[model samples]
Target: MKPLKEVAMSYMALSEAQKKLEEGAFGEAAGESSKAMEFSKTMPPGETFDHDGFDALCYAVLASARAGLGEYDACLEASGRALHYFNRRGELQQDEGKQWIAVVFSRGVAFHETGVYDEALKNLNMAGEMITERKGELPGKEAMLKEIERRKSMLLEEEKSQRKPGYKAWWEFWS
Candidate 1:
């Protein structure tokens, strides 16, 4: 069995990676997240230890780093893996709402970058809803809400711009 200190160190590494991601050090964040993931592999998996949440957090940080590096597809893939881990632990919604929000927001940003505006809006809206539902209780709620609103507005503008002006549906074209 791995030492408890090792697992704690892995968590600390993940936190550092998250900080690097927020600081816009994409390459460094990715490297730190990878190191944490390697350490996670050494720990025994169990719900009691929150191994799933740890894995999810690592993937979420990795996704954010990938997005910052403009690797949209890889960002989406990593965010999906993070959500997969989060979903596997159904109880995580109450305890790890913030992590869930991060993963979803990462996916939304990736989708937006990839030109999937609808999916981006859906994910951003979901993240917004999660924040709103947990408002005042969650840390960084205001910042998360602001980011979501900004992304939503951007997506709406892009979607509107993508539409052809004065274009009509087939049925309307006949009229």
Candidate 2:
């Protein structure tokens, strides 16, 4: 196992990344999250803690940061990795469940920005369900729910506007 000091430092960096993200300093948040990920990589094999969940948290932070910077493709890629790690954990602990919400939300936004409306809406719906299910565990639950709804509405509006006003079916020919 890696030294306890190193593990502590990694968590500290992750904490800082979270703070920077909350402050809207996307670049700094990404840097800190990357640092945390690198530090965690140095950890010796067979550590007792949930390394996958930790890695997922780092990727989720990076995804959110990238999304804030308008780098949707990178955001989606990172979020996908985060989701992979999250799924690998199987049944989630309370903390991991909280992180999962953020991962899903960021992924949804990335998909929406990339014009993948179906996937975007699917993820947003998932996030909303997750938040609702974990309402007691999450702080600012009401605000998060509102934000999810707002994003869902935004996605729907965009999808509607982007659709071509053509026939609904192969048999339909009316204008």
All models: lDDT? Answer: 0.82, 0.84
What is the clash count for each candidate, in the order shown? 0, 0
Candidate 1 per-residue lDDT over residues 1-175, each given as its tens digit: 5558678778889989978987889999999998998887776665256666788888888988998899999999999989898767634347566677777888998898888988999999987877777644665677778888898998888777877999777999998
Candidate 2 overall Cα lDDT vs. reference?
0.84
Q: State which candidate has the highest TM-score.
A: 2
**Candidate 2 structure quality by residue, lDDT tens digits, 30-82:** 99999998888787776666777788899989998999999999999999999
lDDT of 1: 0.82
Candidate 2: clashing pairs of residues? none
Relative to the true structure, candidate 1 reaches a TM of: 0.79
RMSD values, in order shown: 3.3, 3.2
- Model 1 clash tally, residue pairs: 0
- After best superposition, candidate 2 residue 43: deviation in angstroms? 2.6
TM-score of each: 0.79, 0.83
